[model samples]
Target: MKKDPSIMKENMKWTLAMDEVFIQALLDQHYKGFRMDGTFTQTAYNNIINELKEKLGIEFTKSHLKNRLKTLKEHFKESYDFFRNGKLSGFSWNPFTKTWCAEPEVWEQLLQEKPEAIRWKTKVINH
Candidate 1:
């Protein structure tokens, strides 16, 4: 039996969407490297994006995803701080430390978030 190319394309679309909805751990590893504790500033992020674009033979980046997620994080942080500490600093710090002290949870969260960011920047969000 043969399949239509259009049908195959449509199926692929749904498959990719589902993949993005769920987290991909392998890609998540890429995000972990961008961890903020001691690596990856904004400039560095841009450089990484450039390299990825070259490798992927396409355009777009995790920076776009970061912008959107940053918005979500900022709002949540403000709400949390308002209730917990009555303040939300605009600045964000990597919660991780050398020994799982300050930001262990943060590091875990990054594993999820970074992959989402890459997907969003490359696929979901448009320029």
Candidate 2:
């Protein structure tokens, strides 16, 4: 649905200024990924800001936009060891699968062999 101009203005007033909008975008990109089909991509930071300008009628450049997103990632990592290990899927510890089962298997496979990670995680989880 198209936002009414007056309502859009009110939303803008309540929203944080550009650059400061990092955390939400970072989390959104990490978790939400894409919303408008494939408008968002692996290199989506620039596209997202450009589209946001059209959607929100606010302007931001690619460089600063990326910087803001990077800072948000840094903040998230600094605050959590789970994120440092790239585990941000937010699952309760399952004794049967000590690892975050909420995460996709491919995500756990990034560093080591998939089967090994699964086996190790399974043991830790049960141990």
Give all TM-scores, in the order shown: 0.27, 0.33
Q: Global lDDT of each model? A: 0.39, 0.48
RMSD of each: 14.7, 13.9
Indicate the residue-level lDDT of 120 in model 2.
Answer: 31
How do the residues 53-113 of candidate 1 rate in per-residue lDDT, one tens digit apiece? 4554334345443553455457455434432432222213323421111234543454364
- Which pairs of residues collide in model 2? 98-125
Q: Which 10 consecutive positions of candidate 2 have the poorest summed lDDT?
A: 118-127
TM value for model 1 = 0.27
Which stretches of candidate 2 lie above 4 Å from their native place? 1-43, 82-127
Query: Which candidate tops lDDT?
Result: 2
Candidate 2's TM-score reads: 0.33
